[model samples]
Target: MGLQTQLRRAIAVYRFVALGYPVLLGALAFDALQRPVAAAALVALLIGWTAAVSYRYTRNGYEPKVVYTDLAVTAAAVALSAWALAVSDRAWPISLGPWLAGIVLVWGAAWGRRSGAVAGGVIAVFGMVFRGGINENTVNEAALLVLTGFTMGHLVRLGVEAEERTRRATERDAAARERERLARDIHDSVLQVLALVQRRGNEIGGEAAELGRLAGRQEEALRALISSEAYRHPLDGRRDLRELIGRHAGESVTVAAPATPVRLPTATAQEVAAAVASAVDNVREHCPDGTRVWLLVEDDGEAVTVSVRDDGPGIAPGRLAAAAAEGRLGVAQSIEGRVRELGGTVQVVSGPGQGTEIEMRVPRPREGDADGDAHRGR
Candidate 1:
């Protein structure tokens, strides 16, 4: 059941327990004969308050302000019960039995351990003040309230964490399956055609041999792309994009990032890292020998950015558009497509002899966001 449903059920159980308080007062009404009307009025208030709070709890989602107000009212009712009984000289105790303690538990279960502890302590002290002194019964009641609140709060937090883990695992599994399907398609169709073109071009000779070499290189790039573990489940629960992107640094490639971690969702970091890797690959393919590449990662709180730049002779204007028209889809699909899937933007900045830079910016995921859907679709 959902957390709210569990809360509602627990509240219902408390209401049933609260029912006995009125019954107890009715059975012992004769004991309060000195101030019978006052005792009866207190009893009516307790029952009515319980009913009204129960109705409100059933009709709404958790409202902290309202819940806290209920707690205050519950404490007040307990206080009044003690005052009325004391004035009437009743023999029986003025304690609300387990009813008041349940209110503390609900507070804890709804808000968390801290709230529970405060509510328990507050009501326990009030109960002591009304009951004359702190004795074993009151002590036990207070301890139970604190314990129940702390324990239930932890359980609720754990349940929420477990639900989140399950959702992420499901999305991770779906993404893995999709990647596998794409790998199979690439291997069966594109890889086979590339292999045929390479073989035919080699047999025909002349400029065909040069075309075969380019086709062979592309086939190898495609193979490496499919073999990447970027789609696999992340190593840690939270991902640091800096580490993933920094791993690309080599003899000619330099990585620069902040000393502090740039934290992101695992799947998002992985995809961004993969896109960065593709940018690096483009640099490697087009840049002249001895050319150096630099990767810069930054997190400005609102968004995370990774820029891949190479000190190589850059292409003239319309080169990328021309490549796209000629059916070379690396920049379009690998870099731009991957970033777009994450609800991010990728900008390619380059000009003749001015080097190339692919800068990708992905905004930080917001709280309560369903980021798993994006990963699954990828």
Candidate 2:
């Protein structure tokens, strides 16, 4: 059950327990009492209110306004105790005695510490007003009421927060289990089929060799997607962009980065890395096998810029527009989409004879960010 429901039930139980004190005290002092019928009627009213509040609060919905009303009713009753009760040589105990605590708990459950404290103070004030002045007993009761309300209010807050955390953790655990089941199924069937197609297509030649390469790429990507315990990129914490870009180095690709770490938030770094991967993939798909590619990462104060350069026959004017028209979105979506999503920009520099260069710029993480990853290039 939620914290509010549990607290309401506890308050209900306390109301019943505390109700006995005033009823018993008043009954024992019946002979010396003033206005016996009114006292009996007030006790019955308290009973009816308790039962009604308990029934309503135990159900699904709750109205915060009810707490305020409850406090007002209890205060009015306490304030009238002086005129209603017998004024003999001995001082008669008030009707609500410890039952006042029920109001405090109700306030705590509905709101929090501040409301609880206010309820406690108001209850104490009404009680003192009924007695005409303050005394040792009144002081002690006031302290108890205030402290109990504050403590219970703080506990309710902590309990609700813990319950929310537990719920989120359970959801994440269930999602992970579902993903693992799907991964097992894909590994057993689709991965094997793709591997077979790649091998057999390579055994044949001509267009089959191209088909084999495509199948191999799909198999590699699918395997990585299922096995990695991360999102599209590792975004759990801080990461160095330089380390991620360096992974693209190969026989035909060279990476140039600053001597110092170009630190960025995990999400920003991963997005930047994903965009770079898309650019490298674009080069590999369109250019000749032996074409040289260079990747450079630079920190330009307010922003970080990474440029992917390829020494191949450059893109012709209007070539990208025609490709987009034909629904090919390698450069448009994969490269440009990823960069733009990060609140960054993408610039394509190319011509008919000159080589192509795609530069992506992202805002540098500011100082005092949680990751503490804002950095400059050496």
Best model per lDDT: 2
In candidate 2, the residue pairs with backbone N, CA or C atoms under 3 Å apart (3 or more residues apart, or in different chains) clash, namely: none
TM for candidate 2 is 0.72
lDDT of 1 by residue, 1-378 (tens): 666576767776776687687557546665655556776787777777777777777777557877888888878876776656553554435567777777776776677777777888888887777776678877887788778777766776676667767877787788778888988999999999999999999999998977786688678767766775543444345687776776666788899999999888777888898788778778766776578999999899988889888889987899999999999988888888989998889898898889988899998888446343321211
lDDT of 1 at 125: 82
lDDT by residue for model 2 over 1-378, one digit each (tens)? 766677778889999899998888888888777778777887888899888877887884458777668888888878766666654546745546788898898776667777788889888887777775698878778898888788777787777767766765675577667778888989999999999989999999788888778788668767865765443235435678887777678788899999998888777887898888888878877876688999999997799999999998899999998999999988888889989988899999999768899999999877656333212110
lDDT of model 2, residue 249: 81
Give stretches of model 1 more than 4 Å off.
25-48, 83-92, 133-140, 193-218, 234-265, 280-312, 317-351, 357-378
| C-alpha local distance difference test of each model | 0.76, 0.79
Residue 66 displacement (Å), model 2:
2.7
lDDT of 2 at 76: 83
Model 1 compared with the native: what TM-score? 0.68
lDDT of predicted model 2: 0.79
